[model samples]
Target chain A: MSAREISRLVVPNRGQSVWLVLLSASAMAFLAVFALALSVTSAQLARNWSAALAQTATVRISAPPEEIEAQTAIVLEVLRTTPGIAEANVMVAAEQAALLEAWLGPDLPLDALPLPRLIELTETEEGPDRQGLRLRLAAEAPGAVFDDHTRWRRPLAEAAGRLRAFALVSLGLIGGVTAAIVVLASSAALASNGQVIRVLRLVGARDRFIALAFVRRISSRAFIGAAAGTALGMLALRALPEAGGNVHLLSGLGFSGAGWLLPLAIPPLAMVLAWAASMATAFKLLREVT
Target chain B: MIAFEDVAHDYGGGPLFREVSVRLEPGSFHFLTGPSGAGKSTFLKLCYGELLPSFGVVRLMDRDVRTLSRDALAETRERIGVVHQDCQFLDHLSVEQNVGLPLTATGRPLREADLSDLLGWVGLGEQAEALPPTLSGGERQRAALARAIIAAPNVLLADEPTGNLDWEMSQRLMMLMIELNRMGTAVLIATHDLQLIRFAKAQVNARVMRIAGRRLQIAGADL
Candidate 1:
């Protein structure tokens, strides 16, 4: 029969099972969209954190008040002669006080505290070897210590990677649950419409024809439900707080630019999943009953 | 198109019928008469490949029913139409769609002119748009008959086709079957209504078989 005619043979199924499939698919798709967004956002955060923290180091010199300026000059001279060092500048006393303002209260007595002098270093694309730079600093300036910030960068990147992994796992679980729900609904539809099936079989309908009849109905429902859920999810993400400098993880959990197109694939994927689940379920039931 | 060779069905209990051999030739008409629970329905089911025999073989369209795959069995059934006791139908579909299902379900085009003529032949022209649930007993029976012969099957098997209709309706349906038989389609009607059988025998060459004591026997001239 023509596809249009085959679709016209849609059995009148129970309303409860229909709603079960639609609601479950919608709920699962909504969750999947959120997981997708979180995965994308966390990946972006990880890249940003790694890129900003890499190729930078700090030099701290602890010496007598009279010798602090001389050591700073020596460190700058050594850094300029280094092959991969792009620039080196000693941090002013005011910049050091602002860095400590978050931990120590504002307006601290910097001169009385005898704080260490700090020098900031920016490296070229091919950064200086850490061991070579440390050796040279120690020989030229005895009290100078080179800190490359690897200890701080590793932990932040690891956390973002874990978050992205968790989000991906969540998306997989949602897909599995959606497929299970569709299978249950298909079984219920086939079981409840026994009379319709008998009539169709009596008229010489192949199992394939009967299976297609139910598959089309179920997959279309899943597609529509997933579409609506995806739309709602995108809207919810759009309403979230915007990402900016110093944004926390949860505050900026959304997609930007071309990333919005990713969630649109969810509805089609859900439709294909529902089709496969319902087709398998229908054929199984037809075989058992026959 | 259907042949039974020493067929027997057990159905988990003792055998309902055994050693029944018969063949439905082209352009032949048959009536099966027996008491309640005498395996009349089972015999009809076996004709359409619905049930496999326990002891012997049943062949449809010259192919063994046991060896045919599910798809092959369905293809065999397309050449053999059947009407049930309750006249099953897809309640969601209209009377016309249900009538034309044999053609449409098999991927054949259902010509509107032929469907209208067939519906009118069965006297259901006015109720073409109605649903099966709204149809009366006689209308349902006529609709079922229309669906059966819509594909122009080689053999037509019916079980208790007129059990719920009045005498006039039964005779009307019997006439349609006789006309179909005249057009070279084999007809088999399983019913305990002996009067209907006698009525059919007068107009066409119909053989009457009775299931008694778990065996099929040709009835004598008692009727």
Candidate 2:
């Protein structure tokens, strides 16, 4: 047989450490897949929330019932003449009632409640100058209030950003824990296989040869385990409920078309982690020998 | 070749042996005999560079052992074969793999024909597929010998290679060593078996040395 083949076969394959590394890598990879999915999904949500709200505003007019129609007409005229306003239309009674149905209930009494008339505005890509639009509205119509939804957009964007950051942090933690587990498993394997080291050293085996034996075995095990974990994680993600047009955050917690390829990288990354950890541990343990 | 120049070794309490100077030239056969706890095995260890002399320089392959780096020491050891007293083997591996270790461990390709002939020569051809734990005492010693010489080292150091074997088995192992020495490999065997030493001396011109009084003494020709 070849030397490399023999060196690889020297270390006995049966031990507690083998299973320890396999299971730890699998669990870590599984968690990593979740973190990756979260990050990807949150990034999509952040972009969607920011873009959806960025170029839109709403003007709510509150006046006596007799002046409501007059103020609403004046607000529509002012918005039409505005520089960045792309489209402006008064929200219909049914549309207004539908918006309120979530909070109040079905068949909202639009006539009974003294609700203000709401004018929805969609701006061009450049967006209307909110300060100037507000000044014009205050002068033209005393009851007309122009709101660019800046208050709502800022907080939603920040929340999505924080969620993405949290997912990244989780990924880093998973990698660190995987490395630690691999190192511990490697150390235990070396310590328990003292006889193997002695026999190999007695046969004039170099440290590199001996280290590669353990590193190859341990890292390959990690790769196999992580692959299985990643597969299961992808299946779980695919099983999640699909998010249609609804902007619910947790509804679509999985990858879309191209995003499915991202989780495939996790298993190879785990293999690399195991390789580095076990190689370092093996060299350190061999140095302590002769 | 291994040479010791005024080497003294102490295990931190005091000197186990001191003022020892010896040289094992190529093709020379030497038997080291001493009672238990007389530092015979320690002397063998020094010869193979497993332990450094505390008070003197020990050289292997014409270089100071202390100056050689860890990897360099391993490379030096590839040229010197050692059969430990306990007949250590990787118990998980079969006898054939254990015998082929010196060549394979050193990154040298092992030929099947050569390994088969060597195993047959050592009377272990039938036990090649067996594990170390399943082998008899004599078989283990033979396997250890086969592993030590698989790389064709310049020198072979055996510490009690025949310590646990019967008279016939000991003679058989000694004859193998004698044959290897005839092939120009220096042989050094450390044991308390005087009869084995006498037997080896009859077959070949061998020098017998005794370790006593914390020193190495060349025995007279009476035995």
Candidate 3:
């Protein structure tokens, strides 16, 4: 077929169906992009939490006011002298008060609050094993209790890991749905154009030529639709406010780093979908006719 | 050329015909005349590779019909043109577009003026852009003829070329057929009109073949 002839069929008849596909694809792209963003964000957060808690330990000492300062100093001295000890600092009164502000209101009078003396322990690159350090800390600083942030960090990291897994699962489902929709649309077109096939066949056209007409028509439309959809999705992502900005909740949903490259694939993916769908539909219909 | 030897055919165990043998030579015209139910259409279909014989072989252009691939058969069909009585068409297309269908289908370059020329030969140049639904019976027959020969096929098989035309109209169509024969295109027309055959015999060396009792024989003696 000539360029004029190809345009005559592909351009005119695609009004409603192409619109439907574009609308569906845009919606799917929006969800799909968000799903990928969430997956990456969750994995990043999980990794950050895991690494931060792996080496650090906090010792909270509770004693009489006269002995509290001395006990904290003793704990810091023991940590600094220990093997794999990088540095140890006795947390000041103000530092302890700032830490309490997260749990209680900052305006609360420190005189009225029974806060413990806080001591920070940092490990070197050759950090001591957490199990061995815990035993040593208990023996040297009997009044001191160590908190590795393990109790809080484990569940938080696990939840983020699961969320990333869930987003990946959702992406898989979207891809499956996209393939299924294209197949159905292609099959319907084949059924409606039955006479076109017969006429072409009678005039010495092989099945490949007839199938190519349909494939070219559908694949180009799908490519256009998906490109438009991906553009819209990227635009929506751009319109979104940054994290810690006015729209605090939605800010976490944008692509980062190499993630922006994923949306660029939608158009080609849709082209493949059209080719697979139309070819399968054409050959299946041909079997019925011949 | 098409040859069928000891060909047997049956339509679902009904109206079976056996041991039918015949040969169609190049540049020769044949008329398949018989009663309405004598498998005349079936015989025509077999000659054109539409139906396969039950027991024997059918050779269209020297190749076994059963062994021809779909594309090969499609290429074979390009050499053979068939015009059914109904003259079905895409109603959305104009008369000229309908006539140039064979050219478009086979990837031939379509000339705009050639469409008008074909319509002119059929006396339908004035109705070039008219849709098929608007054409009269005589006009549709002419359009069908224009469609059949647009690709200049070697064989033209028309089933009832003038079934609904008046005496004058039938003569017009017959003249066109005779003109095509003169141009070395073999024509096979199937009809029950004995009068049309008599009119055709005057202009050319035509032969009358009767299809009766599930057999074929030449019979111009009665006329």
Winner on TM-score between 1 and 3 is 1
lDDT per residue for candidate 3 within B1-223, as digits (tens), equals: 7888888788887545667777777788888798897777888888777677877888888899999987788788878877778777766667887777777756677787887787899999899989999999999999989888888888888888899899999999989989998899888889899999988888887777777787776776466
Kindly give the stretch of ten consecutive residues in candidate 2 chain A with the minimal lDDT sum. A242-251
The segments of candidate 1 whose C-alpha lies over 4 angstroms from its true place after superposition are A1-3, A245-247
Per-model i-RMS in Å?
1.8, 0.9, 3.6
Docking class of 1: medium
**Reference-based lDDT, each prediction:** 0.90, 0.90, 0.76
Interface RMSD of 3: 3.6
Sort by DockQ, top down from the best: 2, 1, 3
Isolated chain B TM-score per model: 0.98, 0.98, 0.95
Candidate number with greatest TM-score? 1
Model 3 is docked with a DockQ of 0.36
Q: Name the weakest run of 10 consecutive residues (lDDT summed) in model 1 chain A.
A: A1-10
Model 1, residue A196: C-alpha shift (Å): 1.4
- For model 2, the stretches where C-alpha displacement exceeds 4 angstroms are none
Retained native contacts per candidate, as fractions? 0.66, 0.82, 0.36
